[model samples]
Target chain A: MPVKLYIDAVREALWEEMERDSRVLILGEDVGVRGGVFRVTAGLFERFGEARVIDTPLAESAIVGVAVGASAAGLIPVAEIQFADFILPAVNQIISEAAKLRYRSNNDWHCPLVVRAPYGGGVHGALYHSQCLEALFTHVPGLKVVAPATPHDAKGMLKAAIRDPDPVLFFEHKKLYRSVRGEVPEGDYTVPLGQAQTVREGEDVTVITYGMGVHWALAAADQVAAEGIRVHILDLRSLRPLDEQAVVAAARRTGKVLIVHEDHKFCGFGAELAALICEQALFDLDAPIQRLAGPEVPAMPFCPPLERAYLLNADRVAEAMRRLARF
Target chain B: MMEQARHRRPEAQWRGSGGEVHEFHEVHPGEPPRHRALGLDDAQAVEMYRYMLLARLLDERMWLLNRAGKIPFVVSCQGQEAAQAGAGLALDRQHDYLLPYYRDLCLVLLWGHTPRDELLAAFAKAADPNSGGRQMPCHFSDRKLRIFSGSSPVGTQIPHAVGFALAAKMRGEASVSFVSFGEGTSNQGDFHEALNFAGVHKLPVVFFCENNKYAISVPEHKQLACANVADRAAGYGFEGVTVDGTDALAVYQVVKRAVDKARHGGGPTLVEAKVYRLVPHSSDDDDRSYRPREEVEEARRGDPLVRMRAYLTEVGLWDEAAEVDLRQRIASELDEATAFAEQAPYPPEESLYWYVYGEEETSHAG
Candidate 1:
């Protein structure tokens, strides 16, 4: 085991997979000599050379399009969008081209491609940079959306995404890139897609969240535990093709649930989670499903103080947890 | 009989005179340019003419079926048949990958789709292997023939074709990917991106733009400001050639050279075939709203089929008897295809929800 930053965990997974399979290649803007805007692909370009670690043009549609094509031609490509907000230009390629390649061809062809983008707020990123778009892709069929909440999950899920025989949208929380540190396994490993990680156990209430929400919920759970209220935290690592069984079981375990997410409160991912819980385990629950997410503003502001206020954190999660426990 | 003939319009009335056919060189119809010579024998030349003719015939039949409510839609290759026949025949179908646009009826046929395959797709029958009756007609695709499934979204296939070429280059294979699109598609961001990627990587690909002068009633001048679609290829760091698409031999010669260059790792080349939209864009479109009647008449006079037929007759590979035999053969094949596709069963009810995700058994060990 080795302690690694979350971004480093992703980089290590990319490095390990490229070493393991020559067919797995990397492509995106500034991914080669510049080592990516966030340096997630640092040094892999020199190690693998240009063919495997390609520096592509400033065209998101083409990057995804080429990935779809190359995947069909027997190459597993991991394409990156510098920021998740910039992925709108490529939604056509992502939704129409890559996702439907397998289905439209009637099993004749498929796109085993991974699109990695750093998403979320809390770093003073303004309207352009700090936005969560997972819910948009989550609605699409034939596409798998994953948001890893830990270094271990980051390394494991990315490797799994590359190996899966479909297109995957891996949304890496930018705030947790360097802030989160944990022990990551040394050798080849994978956390299967469409699975959930129940990070903490409790008897009173279950805090369901993902990405940065996982960390915030854990801290909220700890503070609440000291006050005599035991809280359970479930990290939904994969959003699309969600772990419904785990979600229902978690809802059944606590009988009271609070869904926390940094995404917008209106029609956010929490909406879907809430719907699933209500649909699956409504009888098991003693209370109505509670959702604590960002206010329905357009996006996060740039000022550090305001950005923190706009984003969800442990303090907000604690308030929500106390309310749920009291209820 | 003479009284019936007298009552007919002067243009329609039969005249007693010596009707003589002229040499191809003598008939300078519709300003056909000097055709570049190809390494094709007389028989091969006849085959080229036949491909263009068959494409036209199939296109006509599709429109008939569509109008009769037997088929849903048709994206015709009527006026661009020369470009389709010549460029498609130029590729090495045995090894090359083809990414044909929706209007490429003849090009897909060169890649080995039978008349029945087209009809079955038009009928959206259960036996239609292109998409298992899922996709619409004219969206040609078949893995067995190396034809990647085409999309209704124009210019999307350009990148996929480039990907195929990249795969060939990495595998150390001599295979080339040939992709086609309408001139209007050149304005798409995907077009620029695909060519840019191919140029940067020096992929073994050839981009063919079937410049049919109109994209469903939007004229080319309004779509692109450049002098020609081929002119835009220079931005992608490749050679560009604008050939007279009416001359099947010239189109064949130009595309043949491009295929050879791509196979030799010379990077991609853009070929713009300046053809006319012989009919409305599709069975659903009405060109009279935008395209002038005089312009349509001019294009009909320079029809690729008429030009190619003249070339075949001049080369002495065709005659009235041969023409009659060829028509009869083509008509019989189409008749058989029509009967088969018409009677083909609809897909099973459960199949409507199939293929949205793969059926591969996932490994639970991960």
Candidate 2:
């Protein structure tokens, strides 16, 4: 076992998969030479050479579009979108092309593409740089959306996405790239998609969250523990084809649920979680399902205080947890 | 006299003075006929004519079916048959990949799509191999034939074709990826991005543009700022050639050279085949609202089907009896295909949920 940073874990998965499979290749902006903006793809270019580690032009649509095409031609293409906010130019390729390739072609063709994009806010990256786009892709039926919080899940789930037979959107929270470090297995391993992991067990309240929110929830749960509030934390690693059993069971465990995410409160991934709990475990709930999320502003503001206020930190999560527990 | 009658029409009003009719014999007089010099035998030339006629006949039948309420839609290949058939015949059908737009009825047919398959898709039946009644008609795709499936969004297939080319290059195969669209599609971001990528990678791709003067209602003048769609290829670092699309032999010569060049590692070529749209855009469209009736009549006068037949006749490869027999054969084929498709059952409702994701877990080859 090795303790690895979240970004390094992701890089290990790519390196292992590329070594294991010759057909697996990476193409995106700055993925080669410069080793990606976040250095998640560092050292892969020199090891895999230029062909396997392609450095494409600064075109997001072409990045995703070429991946869609390459996947159909028996190549596993991992396309990087530079940033999640820049992925808007490629929405047609993802939603209309990659997501619908299998269904629209009646299984004659399938696009096995992995679109890796760094997402979420809190590093003073305002407007364009910081945005959560998982909710946009989760709405698409044929696309699998995954946001792994820890190094272990990041490594395992990335391997699974590379090997997936369908298209997947892998969202990596930039704030956790270096800040988060956890034990990861040394060799080949895969965490099956569409499953949730209950990292902590408790009884008073259940906090359903994912990505950076998971880390915040864990810290908040620890803070609330001294106040005699046992907070349960369920990290939804896979957003689409969500682990419904885990979500319902977690809600039923404490009869109190709080959905948290970095995305907007309206029509966010949290809304879907709240709705699922209400539908499946309504009778088991003691208090109304609560959601602690970013405000409905256009985006995270640039000002330091406003940015801090816009984000869901441990204090915010702990306050929400205490309120739900008391309720 | 027939050549004068066919070649006398102005190359399209939008083309201005640059759209001169280029005669193959004028370049190499006393050489063999156009198709012979282009490496086509007399029979192959006549076969090309047959495919062009088949496309025209099938398209006419579809229009009738639409007008009679037998089918719901008709996106025609009425005037672009020569370009489609010629480019299709020039490709290595066994190895090459064809990503065709909706108007490529003849191209798909030449690539092994049967008349029944076309009608089945037109009827959106369960046996429609293209999509199993999921997509609209003329969205051609056949796995066995190596034809990539296309969507309604224009120019998306450009990148897909380039991807196929990239695959062929990486796999060390001598396969070329051929894709076709109208001139309007050249303006799409996918088109520019795809071509730019292919140019950078030097991928083996052939971008065939059927410049039929109109994209639905938008004419060539409105669709492009440049003189020819091929001219845009210079920006992407490839050879671009504009040919008379109505001349099947000329189109064959250009596309054959382009396809051969790509297969031999010469990179991509942008070919603009200047044809015309003889009919309105689609069944839902009424051309009279935008285009005048006289222009449609003038375009019909320079129809590719008629030009191909006359060329075959000039070469002594066709006669009145052959023409009559071919029409009879096509009519019967159309009748049988129409009846079969009309009686075919729609896909079962449950199949709607199927194929959203691959049913089987395909193991990754390690």
Candidate 3:
């Protein structure tokens, strides 16, 4: 097993899948000769040739729209929206068109497409580039929103998304792309979608999180370990088809519940998780559900201190957990 | 009698882009660049006339139904029938795909949607083949027929159609996808993006712009600075041409050439059919507020159905008795379709959840 960065894991999956299936092609702005601005597709253009690794003009809506159409027509396209914020222009095509194709046409037509975007704050990407859009897409019925926090999950979830029979929106945390590294198994493997991972197991508090929040919760758990408090961090890798079993089990095992995420506090994914916990394991609760998430700001500002204050960090998670434990 | 004979060819002062003064004989006032020839024989010409007549009759009936509080809505295809039918009929039906907009009743009809299919959609009936009564009227779709179900958002279908072309090109197939929209829709960013992608990739697709003049009360002059929508294709580095939309044969000829070019891998083409809205934009709209009533009356003077009927009569392809028989036959068919749709059952109450996600996976979390 070789240690790989989160972005490298994503690239490996794309490269391996394209090599495995001739129908699989990559299309996005600067994805070909430029190998993507982030270089996640660094050598794919040279390896697969121009047609398979297409460098599209700067058009987000067309990129997704073409993928929807092409996917229906028999080709599997993995379209990349340069950043998460840029995907707004293509929401109509993804939500209104591709997502509805299967149901609207009564399964006569379907678009098996994947859209990958680098999301989250702390990269100093500021307002436009550091937004989390998983909640918005997760609300859509047909779409499957994937947010992988580890190198292993990144590779496995991306491969699974590519081979999925429906359209998938894969969000790769930009800060985790280079910062996080882990040992990835050398053979073919796929982490099943809609399953949660108990990254850390303990009994004092149940900290449910995903993406960068998982890493923060781990740090927070270590900090709280000194105080004799054990935190069980459950990484909800797949947001859309959330594992209700894991969410309920975590809530029941450790009644002290804390939900953490980088998305907004108002109507964020945490609210949904909180709702699920209430519905499935409300009587099991020892105290109220404590949510540690980004404030209801428009976006993360460009200033470093402001950006740090705007984002949810491990210290914040630890401090919130201490208060929940006290409660 | 001599003046009336010449009335068949309306003469107008035409200004070329090169600043040349010329006189052209038009079958209608806005008859595009060429209208002198058609490839259809006597019977085929008569069939084309019949389709236009049927489309017009269907449009009129839908309006009546809407007014009678029967159908929920009516998006008129009154002025663009000739262009839609012509371009639609010219395609290789067995292979090509269709992505028609809301104002494409005639195109969808020519693509094999029966009058009952349109009526069922209007009534939002259970057996409606397009969407199982899920979609609104005019959002035409037929999976078996390779028609993409379009949405209310304008220009979104352009890229989807290009995807069809992209698939064909990648597979090395000769199939092409035909997508239609109004002139105002061409102003959208997706339209530009789709055209640019198709042009760059050299995909097999036809972008047909039916310039019906008004996009919900906004005129052509207000929509774009370019002379015509087809001109935008040249900027995308593909072949583009504008033809007389009212002249069915001419539109057919131009679109046929473009389709051939695309199928053979020559690349995409943009076609603008300069059409008029003979009626209000929709049953709910009142054109009186925006433009003068005389403009609507003037457009009706060169109605495509009337012009096509005249052309057929001139070539000895149609007669008054044939017209009377065709009208009677279409009238009876319309009656049958309307009565059937009016009495059709609405979708079952539980059926609302159907098709919201994959049919196999019914357990969806809110």
Candidate 4:
């Protein structure tokens, strides 16, 4: 096994997949010569040439819309939105066109498009650059949403997304791109979509989270272990078509569940997780479901104090876990 | 009655130095016929006229069905039949892809959609090949015929057409993607974005704007800040042409040239077909609310079907017997389609849950 950064894992997936299948192409702003704004797609343009690594105009709508059309025409298109906040202009293309193509055509036409965007806050990227929009796409029925927390998951899930017969939204946490590192398998492998994995097992409380929140929960679990309060952690790799069985099983194991995410606490992905937990394992719960998420502000502010106060960390997760354990 | 009205109106004339307006009859006293000059033989010209006539009859029948409370909606292609039929016939239907808007009955028919298929979709029957009763009427799609599925969101199909062209270029195929929309749709951001992308990439796609003057009550002057939709193509670095949509031969010549240029790697073209909507926007709309009734009656005088028929008759390829026989044949086909669609069953209740995702693993596994 070789250790790799989360961003490198994603790059490797693109490099390997494009090498394996000539139909796999990348299109977005600065993806050709510049190798993407964050260097996530670095060196791909040089290797695959201009035809596969397309550099599009500054329009987000065209980037996604063209991908939708190309996917239907038997080419695997992986479109990139420069930032998650800027993806609003392409909501119509993503939600209305790509999401409904197969269903509207009655399976006569399908869009195998993968739209990747750098999301989440932490590196002083306030407001516009730092936002989690996975919840918005998760609400769309025909689209599959995924957020990978580790290098292993990022590489495998991206390969799966590119291979999917339908449209997929792959949200990469910008903060974890270079910060997270783990051992990734050398050869081709895939982490199936719509499945959840239990990272840490315990007998006290279960912390369900994804993306950046997953790392925070794991740290909190380790910190709380000193106090004899064992914590269970479940990383939900797939948001849409949620792993209901794993969610319920995690809830039933410890009888105390705490949901965590960086999105708004109101109507966030955590709310859906809470609803699913209560619906399936309501009687198994020893205490009420606890949710730890960002405050309901419009977005993350610029200043360090305000930004720190807005985002969740290991201390915040530990405090929430302590409160739930006391209950 | 129509012949008497035709004799009443003055001879249609071409004006403007820019060629924005075209003469109704392209055959001058001494020169060759316009269709012959455009490389269309006698049979091809007659077939174009027949397609325009079939579209008119089919559209008129849809209106009757709507008025009789038999169908839910009617989006007429009354005044733009020449633009549809002529441009459609010019494409290499065997290899090209069509992304048509709602008012493209004639174009889809030229691409292999039969009168019965249109009727089945209009009735929202189970056998409807477009959407299996899921979409509204005129939202065309047929995988076998290479007609890309379109939605009601006006200009969204523009980029999709560009994508098809992009794929064709990538695969080293000489396929052109043809897309059509109304004049108002040119204002959409997707339209500009799609055109710019296609221009930069030199993709093989054609952006056809059937400028029917009004986009559901908003007149052309109110919709555009420039003189013509075709003029906007210059900003994207491409050739743009404006032609009279009522003259089938003129439209055929322009579209054929554009398609040929695209297939040879010359990039995209913006073609604006100046025409009119001969009816209200849809069955639910009432033209009396905004425009005067006389304006619509005036537009009916330049109907593409009527103009194409007159051209065919002048060229000695059509006569009273030919007209009567064509109408009789279309009437029987329309009658049979109506009866079959009216009795066709709606999609099954459980079908609503199907096709949301593919059932099998269509992924390219390593």
lDDT of each: 0.85, 0.89, 0.86, 0.90
For A1-327, candidate 2 gives per-residue lDDT tens digits of 789999999999999999999999999999999999999999999999999899998888888988888889999999999889999999998988999988888888899989999999988899989999888999999999999999999999999999999999999999999999999988999999999999999999999999999999999999999999998999999998799999999999999999999999899998888899888989999999998988988998899999988888999999999999988
Q: Residue A198 of candidate 2: its Cα lDDT?
A: 97
DockQ comparison, 1 vs 3, better candidate: 3
Off by over 4 Å in 3: B1-38, B359-366
lDDT of 3 by residue, B1-366 (tens): 001111223323322232121222333455422233445555666667788888889989999999999888898899888888789768988899999999888888888888999899899897788887887888888878989878788999999999999888888888999999999999998899999999998999999999988889999999989888888987899877888788787788888888999999898989988889888888889989999987886677667787777666655566789999999999999999999998999977876676554537555321
Residue by residue across A1-327, what tens digits does model 3's lDDT show?
Answer: 899999899999999999899999999999999999888999999999998899998999999999998998889999999999999999999999888887776555788999999999898899999999888898899898989999999999999999988999999999998999998999778997899999998988999999999999999889998998888889999998889999999888889999999999789999999999999888999999988888888999999999989988888999988888888
DockQ of each: 0.67, 0.76, 0.70, 0.80
Clashing pairs in 3: none
The model with the greater lDDT, 2 or 3, is: 2
Question: Please, what are the lDDT tens digits per residue for candidate 4 over residues A269-317?
Answer: 9889899888889999999999999899999998999999999999999
Query: Candidate 1, residue A123: CA error in Å?
Result: 1.8
Give every prediction's interface RMSD: 1.4, 1.3, 1.7, 1.2
The candidate, 3 or 4, that scores higher on DockQ is 4
Best by TM-score: 4
TM-score, prediction 1? 0.94
Q: Per-residue lDDT of B154-216 in model 1, one digit per residue for the tens? A: 899998898788778877899999999999899999999999999988999999999999988
Show model 4 residue runs off by greater than 4 Å: B1-11, B14-25, B360-366
TM-score of chain B of each: 0.89, 0.91, 0.89, 0.92
TM-score of each: 0.94, 0.95, 0.93, 0.96
- For residues B1-366, what per-residue lDDT tens digits would candidate 4 score against the true structure? 001111122434432222222334555788777788788899989989888899899999999999999999989898999999889889999999999999999999999999999999999998889997889999999999999999888799999999999999999999999999999999999999999999999999999999999989899999999989999899898988888788787788888988999999999999988889988999999889889988887777666676777677777788889999999999999999999999999987967777777644244111
lDDT of 2 by residue, B1-366 (tens): 001112223445323232222321122346666677778998888888888888888888888999999889999998999998889889989999999999999998889988999999999998898998899899998888999988898999999998898888888999999999999999999999999999999999999999999888899999999899998889989888888888787788888988999999999999989889988889999999889998887777677777777667666677889999999999999999999999999988867778777744253111
Query: Could you arrange the candidates by DockQ from highest to lowest?
Result: 4, 2, 3, 1
